[model samples]
Target: MSANLESVTDTADLAQSLREVFGRAQRALREQSGRFGLTPSQAEALGYVLRDGPLTITALAKRQSVRSQSMGATVGVLLEQELVTVTPDPSDGRQKVVTVTEKARALVAKGRNARTDWFAKQLDTLSPGELRTLAEAQKLLGRIFP
Candidate 1:
């Protein structure tokens, strides 16, 4: 194989490794979110509402990358659980805007704190150099998506 071709292959392998690591991290977070009494989809929906405030059902569906019907089911469940509420949209009277409730916000905050605590404990076990490397990798990952 040519030297340049080998280098490209090596880079692809490294990117795959990074992708796997990210997937694992996401899985871990999802598992932890379940412990906080939320399904992965529900937690993700709450996260969007928290970040973006109230949104029409169609808008929330788009943000969650789910079909409107699927998002409607999720929103129904959240409403039943009292984690979210709907208000009539001012701009569009026919549409209802979904917003996270205070209870949902508290639940999300607790879940985040739990995940951060777990990550912090794990980071403490790593060597300082390892921690620094992780910090740099985080910055690199940000750039990769951005």
Candidate 2:
């Protein structure tokens, strides 16, 4: 790329673009998640549990970037729904670890499958060159964040 082109790509510009794209993609995915009977927060919390396995309420709150009280409320709802369960934390007697139950796993899998199917359909509509461009963009996005 030319020096002029590089100069035009300021950090602010890149950050804004990343934020916009991420927001749009999340909104789209959340719509699909809703169809599977989950709110955005519920889906996000489930994903955190699925990816990180069992975690304490405080840890999950931190991972979700929300206050502990907020996370407690979310967890409470999840527990009431039987989507998650609390187990004794082996390392900390006072702390309980929250994990996805089989029901939550099934729900998450179904929701993820729905989102993937939607993306797959969209990808199918793209030309080979366009798909290649998206693949390259994915790499670029990873590099930008890293």
Candidate 3:
């Protein structure tokens, strides 16, 4: 609570720590999707498609901040793997809509379950005081993020 906010080193160290922890946590969760033979980009694209119902490659690319060609390649792999299907967009015949198949949904669900179970197991090991501290820290983070 007495930390110096004006110090450049303090800010840099805090930023580095946040990035390292977040990156590690994300990598661990992403590992759950590895068993399905999906690359990170493919997994991400499928997640967006699954969550948003259907989307065009341009939409996906824009959401992901990638070039359309890159998203198209990812979509191609998804189509070849039968994880997604593409059909003419009802609103725009010139555009194609990408949709997740049942297989992709099941895969995403299983991966999510795995990540949840893994994190829950980790959390279970925390002491009551530690858990409370983590909750307080999360609230502080929410203030910064939200």
TM-score for every candidate vs. truth? 0.83, 0.74, 0.79
Better of 2 and 3 by TM-score: 3
Ranking by TM-score: 1, 3, 2
lDDT by residue for model 3 (36-146), tens: 887878878998999998999989999999998899999999999999999998888988899999998888788889899988899999999999999999999999899
- In model 1, what lDDT does residue 83 have? 92
Clashing pairs in 3: none
lDDT of candidates 1 onward, in order: 0.84, 0.83, 0.90
Per model, state how many residue pairs clash: 0, 0, 0
Candidate 3 segments whose C-alpha is farther than 4 A from its true place: 1-9, 64-70
- The C-alpha stretches of model 1 lying farther than 4 A from their native spots are 64-70
Considering lDDT, where higher is better, how would the candidates rank from best to worst? 3, 1, 2
- Select the stronger candidate by TM-score from 1 and 2: 1
- Screening candidate 2 with a backbone cut-off below 3 angstroms (N, C-alpha, C), the clashing residue pairs are none
Give the Cα-based TM-score of candidate 1 against the true structure.
Answer: 0.83
